[model samples]
Target chain A: AQSVAQPEDQVNVAEGNPLTVKCTYSVSGNPYLFWYVQYPNRGLQFLLKYITGDNLVKGSYGFEAEFNKSQTSFHLKKPSALVSDSALYFCAVRAYDSNYQLIWGAGTKLIIKP
Target chain B: NAGVTQTPKFRILKIGQSMTLQCTQDMNHNYMYWYRQDPGMGLKLIYYSVGAGITDKGEVPNGYNVSRSTTEDFPLRLELAAPSQTSVYFCASSDRGSNQPQHFGDGTRLSIL
Candidate 1:
């Protein structure tokens, strides 16, 4: 079976500061990774995905994630943080075993302080 | 377009009660999925359908059922609701290929007492 993990339950960042939410994965075949954000009582919004391209994948809202095959990680990053950036971040991976269903991490709560 | 839509934005059910959560998509995507989100635990897939009339179990498929009678709708049925089943439910759809990303609905908040 494949799985994803987010080590940090919560991340605190100040406005204008660079923020990073870490994600790691364990899969049998090539990993299809994705990032999503969720606001209060809202559904998830897709951020970006890493299929088989450049390790550094840029996404919406100035967010990006670097896929490190050696590290078995795909960490979400942003050049600067804003108060509105505070939300729940999720990292998902689709393993070869289950090409259609995604294996998700526990989730990381990102709080950006103004 | 309303990419994905889930009805009954919020619902409260008593233990042993039954309810069906409705989901509809306008994109005509070949793939549809149901997932439940809980605190600390990320979204877990409950069921998925590749197309109309075809359904399969997902990561956490217990105490729930789903059907894809038409290409645009996939409804999840919960028979005998339990506290454990109380969570935010999401419906999503994607194109036929694995490379396509899934579009999600606003979600339905279900609380079981």
Candidate 2:
């Protein structure tokens, strides 16, 4: 079964500083990894996805993620954080050969302190 | 164009009551899904439909039922509501395949008392 683990429950970063949210995955076949962000009282918004290509995948809102096969990790990154960036982030993984029913992490709360 | 729409933004039900949460998509997506989000937890899939006539159970399908009678609508039914079923439900849709990104509705918050 494909599964995603987010080690951190919450991450705090100062505004204008770089931020990183860690994610790891376990799957049998090639992995399709994705990142999503959800604001309070709103549905999740897709950030980025890594199917197969460059290791560094850029996504919406100046966010990017690095897919490291050896480490089995895909961590989200941003050069500069903003107050509005504070939200709940989820990491998801799906097996390439399957129907893409995603398995998601518990979620990581990111707080940008000004 | 309203990407995905969900009705009954908020609802409160008594125990043993029944209710349906309505969902519709204008994108003409062939794949639709229902998920519930509990406090401090990630979303759990309740049901999914590959097409109009095909529906399947997901990870957390108990106490919940769903039907997709058309390409645009997928409604979730809850029979004999319980406090354990109270949570925020979200409806999402994607294209025919698994590679497409899922578009999500605002979500419906349901509480059982």
Candidate 3:
């Protein structure tokens, strides 16, 4: 089975400052990772995915995540935060050999302060 | 393109009652999924369909039933509503390949009393 862990329950950062939300995973085989964001009372929107590409993957809203094989981590990062970026972020993973069923994290609430 | 659409944005059901959450996608994608989101638990897949008339259980499929009669419609049924079933249900659709990203609907908020 595959599992994802978002170590932080909440992260606060000032607007225009660099921000990071940590995520790590454990899977038996090659990992297919994804990041999603959810606004209030809305469905989750896909941010980015890491399958078999460069170490860094970029997605919507100027967000990016770095996939580190050695650390078993795929942390979401933004060069500068915006208040509109505040939302619930989730990290999900699926094992390559599995039936393509994804395992999601508990979610991390990101707040961009003005 | 409306991507995915879910009906009855908000619903309240009493314990032991039953209800069905409707989901439809216009993308003509081959993969569709149902997931429930709790306060902090993120999203847990309740069921998924690879194509029309084919369905499979997901991570948390207990007390839930789903059907994929057509390529665009996948509805989830709750046999007996329980407090534990109260959560925001999201319907998503993706292309056939594993490399494609899933598109999600706004979600339906269901509360069990």
Best by DockQ: 3
Question: How much of the true A–B contact set does each candidate keep?
Answer: 0.71, 0.51, 0.85
User: What are the runs in model 3 whose C-alpha is more than 4 Å off?
Assistant: none
* Each model's Cα RMSD: 1.0, 0.9, 1.0
Per-residue lDDT tens digits for candidate 3, residues A1-114, read 467899999999999999999999999978889999988888889999999979999999999999999999999999999999999999988788776677899999999999
Q: Write the per-residue lDDT of candidate 1 for residues B1-113, one digit (tens) a residue.
A: 97899999999999999999999999989999999988888888999999999999988999999999899999999999999998999999999877678899999999999
Each prediction's Cα lDDT score? 0.93, 0.93, 0.93
Worst 10 residues of 3 chain A by lDDT: A94-103
- Name model 1 segments beyond 4 Å from true: none
CAPRI-style class, candidate 1:
medium
Estimate the TM-score of every prediction.
0.97, 0.98, 0.97
- Colliding pairs, model 1: none
Tens digits of per-residue lDDT, candidate 1, A1-114, equal: 578999999999999999999999999889899999998988889999999979999999999999999999999999999999999999998886674888889999999999
TM-score, candidate 2, first chain: 0.97
Model 2 pairs whose backbones collide: none
Write down the worst ten-residue block by lDDT for model 1 chain B: B96-105
TM-score of chain B of 1: 0.98
